[model samples]
Target: MRDYVQTAEEAARRAGHVLRAWSSKFTVREKSRSNLVTEADEAAQAAIHDFIHGRYPHHGFCGEEGLSVAGNDSTYRWVIDPLDGTTNYVHGFPYYSVSIGLECRGEMIVGAIFDPIHDEMFLAVRGEGATLNRRPLRCSAINQLDQALVIASLPVNTDRHDEAVRRFLSVLPVAQAVQRTGSAALNLANIAAGRVDGFWSTSLKPWDMAAGILLVEEAGGRISKIDGSAFQLEVPNLLASNGLALHEQLVAALV
Candidate 1:
């Protein structure tokens, strides 16, 4: 493994440890009417920050707990979500995870996501394909829209409910099923592992989707802005799919 990837894996695992430790013993605070954050999130971010900064002193970081430093002269940047699925975690749902990604020169290069509850780790490096616990992963081969299981995320705390509902309805006729998993990190991880056919969500932070995007691509899936444009951290909209043809059709229908 590349040094950065190795370091990321270590950081992710350590963050997972922090997450597990605080899983049920933490207090939740409302960040918004529909959003929550827990002590686990902050603790996990602190551990990741410590681990990564110890090895790569100058690398930039943008973490979910609001950890950011001065941009580095180097091209590398770390995007982290110390705890994803916070609401789920607080409610005793076991779907939360720690996501970490390294982007170099505007391209996502390494990604790792650890689901501490399940002890599952998904990892990918640019051009190296994706894996879960060292086993290679491939996206599903399903091509027909009606045979696909899709995930759609609606912005709960925003006024996008009607628009989100309209979009979901438009795609519902063509999809076999649709779900809202509440965790972009897990959504992308499942896409990479072929457990789900595709995922679409608006209103995400860079830390939430960065790692999972690289994982999906490396697992032979396609990812893009909802309008089919290339995705970037600033413009956080994303649509990841196993079947390109179906993805295009869905995008066309929504637009």
Candidate 2:
């Protein structure tokens, strides 16, 4: 799967380049009241799709910028988020990334995430292993929720009455700490690298969680629905942890 890994990395890097080029001059628009999309997002997605589709002309494509292409093999597809943290990029927060994952028959077989600002590349192949910048990756061994640094994803413009906010509040006192990052992809990548102990989200799309799911699994983490049920990509209610004591505790807390 060297070619798969190489192509994913190259595509992600290409998108990252496009993001950087447009960073200084991009115009922003809202996808919703507080949800932002920018010219940079579209341009980076174009760059990513062009590079990947040129290599595998028949591979289906799904991207965050409303790009959808069906190749001859419907079972083989590339899921992409050209700019995983658009708000972060817009504000120069430097926490965004380009995420790409290859799925076969609804199962992710390869995944790659690239942080252009930091020049970090994370990759994983099913049953093989996960890596960060060519070095092996493993989840942190924190076994207890009280000692974990956990993160959650709440939708933009979320308020106190939102279910997501309720979930966040429930975990606030139980886990060591609870934080929110604008980028879910980066959060997952950090989990794989043993930098973050856990992450849970009830609001994320396929592109946001697709690649990172494989990365976490390969890095020795466990993933499931917030209530510890089987996770389905179509309806994302995910809770991912280091597969130690935090998993069950998180499930109980989230429920």
Off by over 4 Å in 1: 158-161
Candidate 2's C-alpha runs over 4 A off are none
Clashes of 1: 0
Report the C-alpha displacement of residue 62, candidate 2, in angstroms. 0.8
TM-score of each: 0.96, 0.98
lDDT for 167 in candidate 1 is: 79
TM-score, structure 1 vs. true: 0.96
Write the residue-wise lDDT of candidate 1 on 77-139 in tens digits.
899999989988888888888999998888889999999989999999999999999999999
How does candidate 1 score on lDDT?
0.87
Query: What local distance difference test score does each model get?
Result: 0.87, 0.93
User: Which is the leading candidate under TM-score?
Assistant: 2
